[model samples]
Target: MDDPTPEVADQEAPSSGIAKAQPEVGPPLVEMVNVWKRFGQGAGETVALAGVDLAIQPGEFVTLIGPSGCGKSTLFNMIAGLTDTDSDGSVVFKNKPQRDGELLGKVSFMPQKDLLFAWRTVLDNATLALEIEGVPRAKARARAEAMFPEFGLAGFEKHYPHQLSGGMRQRVALMRTFLFERELMLLDEPFGALDALTRAMMQRWLLEIWEKHRRTVLFITHDIDEAIFLGDKVVVMTARPGRIKTVETIDLPRPRGAEVITSPEFIEIKRRLLGIVEEESLKSFASAGAS
Candidate 1:
């Protein structure tokens, strides 16, 4: 049978002077087609996702935002290969259909919490994935140590997780994810717990690292500003029985600085997204009240 997934054409560059670099022409790195996921059966059953279709280009940073209970995390789980879609839909990775658990080790995933082990030193925590993959402990440690300076943890290698600040712990957690060396990365609200100031700093730091490495990233966030600032495309999901509401290409440009947030262009994009998100949020609230 012929594949029904639509191919995404390369996006044209915006007229703005600081437009983002265009993705190279090719098949999407990952594509989800008519995906539907349901839980339970009969009267108690819930539809977590319905007819969700999304395509992510290689080396693109895509951020997803939606109201609570909108199945954002469920989408992430499907992409991470931790869960599978219902029989009605398929997840295609690099043009091939992926069965359940097939993408488990192919994509690097980081959940909201730092998940650092308190007993392990910062260096050991950072090298955990590599060590698990049978990279000799010494080799993993060496690889991790070299990245400490770049990740802003140069002198804190010997300290345990308990000794580090929340932001520092997240940096270590992210470093570990990077060390896993997967082509695609699935990050679920990695900086959700940090203070505003700290989160802002981490956002910029993350962009620097992302720009340097150019890994294809799929990030989930509740913060609209974070979604706009970090993504080449901001994907908005609807309320329960979630599906993509819109995919707004962020035309704000590369090497984004704090000043970009207040720019006219950024504000305009934010305004549009805010309206869509607000509408979906209201629907979510109404659904909850009725249920």
Candidate 2:
């Protein structure tokens, strides 16, 4: 396969990249056009994301995957309204432009590390978002308490972060995100730190919950299998100064189990995604060598 031409890591880069799985129908819940992010200028400048366009329908599960330093997390930040896009770019949410500062608290975000507080009990940690929204501690705890059974933390509400296993901590973090109650959820490799078996279990459990709630989710991962398993559409991104390289819709039947990974269709999608990712990864390494 021919190597992908780099996006030049700057504002002068190409305007459009790949936008696969373009909505089957209906308006998108989130849309980003010509987005760019640069840190510093002159010799010390670093371009994180180049011009890119992407859209996700309401309640859709979109998984973003790319090689390291490709700005996968940077893209997530822009969507969560935690970071800003450059001038002339747009981050539109629910039909309104989000460049001015509207996205701040409109979405819920879960980063790689759970960042749970040690002193706080699981209940306190899970209810933190509610507490921030001015809900009384009693009310916040009450609401979170009700969902513990579903979250698998039913009897562990009084347990501290340090007392919980790695997977458990992640579950609490997700519950906190869910309690925030927004239409969009950005999860940045929430399962990246766990053991292989634990990670697999978390993936299955997450799908079940997502099916029940039907909330829109944007997940980031370097693991292609995880990305395909969790997302309705798997979005492949380019090297540093990230941009979409392809957007493939996951056609696998839902309520999926680990056996799904062995299916011929699943294998085919993985093969294609791996080819694109390998090409970009090599390009990134070559650039590093030349630098």
Q: Which of the numbered candidates is closest to the native, going by highest TM-score?
A: 2
- Using Cα atoms with residue i matched to residue i, what is each candidate's TM-score against the true structure? 0.92, 0.93
Which candidate wins on lDDT?
1
Off by over 4 Å in 2: 1-23
| lDDT comparing candidate 2 with the true structure | 0.88
How do the residues 89-179 of candidate 1 rate in per-residue lDDT, one tens digit apiece? 8899999989878988989999999999889999999999999999999999999999999999999999999888999999999999999
For 1-291, candidate 2 gives per-residue lDDT tens digits of: 112233323223335434434545888999987788888877787888877778999999999998889999889989988889977478999989897567999999999999999989999999999999999999998899999999999899999999999999999999999999999999999999999999999999999999999999999999999999888999899888677788888999998999999999999999999998998899899878998
By TM-score, how accurate is candidate 2? 0.93
